[model samples]
Target: MTLGNRKKNAVKAATAAKVDALLVTHLPDVRYVSGFTGSNAALVLTGNRAVLFTDGRYTAQAKAEAAGTRVVIEKKPAVTAACEWIERAGIQRCGFDAAHTTVAALEAMRKAVTSKVRRSLFHPVGALVAALREVKDADEISRMRVAAALGCSLFDQMLSIIEPGMTEIAVAAELEHQARLAGAEGMSFDTIVASGERSALPHGHATTAKLPRQGFVTLDFGVILDGYCSDMTRTVHMGNALPGEHEAYDAVLEAQEAAVAVVAPGVTAGDVDEAARSVLRRAKLDRFFTHSTGHGVGLEIHEGPRLAAKQTQPLAEGMVITIEPGIYIPGRFGLRIEDMVLVTATGGEVLTPSPKAWIQL
Candidate 1:
């Protein structure tokens, strides 16, 4: 969709919510609507007009990038200027994202307007623009595909160089360096290189700990390309795996694949989670499978339509999400197998189709 269409859709949503205008201060939402990518920005949307507010630092950049909106460069803060503009435009009720707005921020926003309308001007709209962003357009899906492919290539390269004696941080550094060389804008998040017992930590960041000779090394990472993010996790063994180690890896793989199989249009996110959890439950490892099954991924690493127990959000076509299932046995070992799966009309398509089989480095 073009930037103008996106703004039009947002305005339609604001109208449905009984608001005259929407004050979008979230950076990603701002980018999605107006194509403005600067650090400071605020987009005000009405039925007939769209205006982007920013400081002088982004005067030229905002004007150039924000294609469908009128650019207003002001010396004051962007949000304050946007609120003031809304009042001047005679907007009675302006919607703002309650999820992203803070108490202090709301107070400041109200202070920007006159006392008569300050108390009731800004209405609390819950994730108005974020809901629109959950489903990927063709352009967004194309960019995400490239990002996922880069992550898969990086994983393939890491298999050749990872050894038992290498430090976890060193492995992360090499992976990041290669990503930069491969034209990645940055990493989606801090690279995770959890080894040995540290694998039990779901979000174990790269540390100085050395890789173990006979334990699992979990590499969970993502990359950003063309303003999109890709996330996948692969756990490999250093030397020989113990008797139960191989079995655990197999169980996690089965669970991850099972979840990926159920991803399709009209499927509930909870059903997908249950599909993975049922596999681990059959293996008697469900207790160790901490965290949700997965989450939606796109402009942000984590988005809406969470795949977890009791989540009722239905999967829609064009939504990209992750299917990651793991078992963390504290002090003993842990393993995770993840893939970026795109929801399609028929079923899920694995974006990161690198080797998920047992890899003993």
Candidate 2:
């Protein structure tokens, strides 16, 4: 979508929130509205205009990137300048995202205006821009598809060289190196290379420990490309898998796929979680299956419409999420399988089409 259309939507949200203007201080929100990817920026949206305030560092960058919006280069803090502009505009109450605004930042913003206006202005509005960003546009989905495809290619390359006795950190380094060569802007998050017992830790990062001769190694990672993110996880056996290990991997894989199957437009997020949890529960592995089934992925690695138990949010078309189900047996073995699925009108489309079948090296 064009920046102009996005700003128009933000103005509608501001009006719905009963505010005269919106002082967007969150960097991501600012980028979403103004297309300004600078480090420091604040977007002010009124009924009739959208203005972006930044420092001298981004004067040229803002002019080039932030199209269809008024750009203002100021010496003061972007948020402070934005609040000052709001006060000068004769706005009685302006809204700011409470989730992204800290107490100190709020105080700084209030200080930029008169004491009387400060007390009444800057209302704490919750996730106004984020709510709008939950559903992706066609262009956004296309960008994310490219990012997901890159992640799948990286996973395939890692499989060719991964072997027993290699340190988990070594594997992570190779994966990251390949990602850069593949044109990834950066990793979506830390490159996870949990091996053997360490795999039992849901978020165990790469360490110096060597891969086990006979156990599971979970590689969970993602890449950022052109500003969007893609996430996927795969677990492979080192030398040989035990009988129980095979069964556990099968259970988790089934769970992950089951969740992805139900990702249609109109299904509640909770229902998707249950689809996965029910499989593990039936297999008697539910207790070991920790963490949510999945979460929405987009401009940020993790965003809205989380696929967890009791989340009432329904899936919408153009929403991309990860369906990851895992089982960790402490001190024994751990395995997980994850895929990025895009919610569609008829069903779900698995974006990360990497093979999830049993892989024994």
Top candidate (lDDT): 1
- Cα lDDT tens digits, model 1, 1-361, are 9998999899999999999999999999999999999999999999999999999998889989998689999999999999999999999999999999999999999999999999889999789899999999999999999999999999999999899889999999999999999999999999999999999999999999999998999999999998899999999998898879999999999999999988899999999999999999999999999999999898899998799999999999999999899999998998899999999999999999999999997
What is the TM-score of candidate 2? 0.99
- Whole-model lDDT, candidate 2? 0.91
Candidate 2, 147-253: lDDT as tens digits = 99999999999989888899999999999999999899999999899998899989989999999888899999999998899999999998878779999998999
When summed lDDT is taken over every stretch of 10 residues in candidate 2, the lowest stretch is 116-125
C-alpha lDDT (0 to 100) for residue 98 of candidate 1: 93
How well does candidate 1 match the true structure in TM-score terms? Answer: 0.99
TM-score of each prediction: 0.99, 0.99
lDDT of 1: 0.94
Query: Could you tell me how far off, in angstroms, the CA of residue 287 lies in candidate 1 after the best superposition?
Result: 0.2
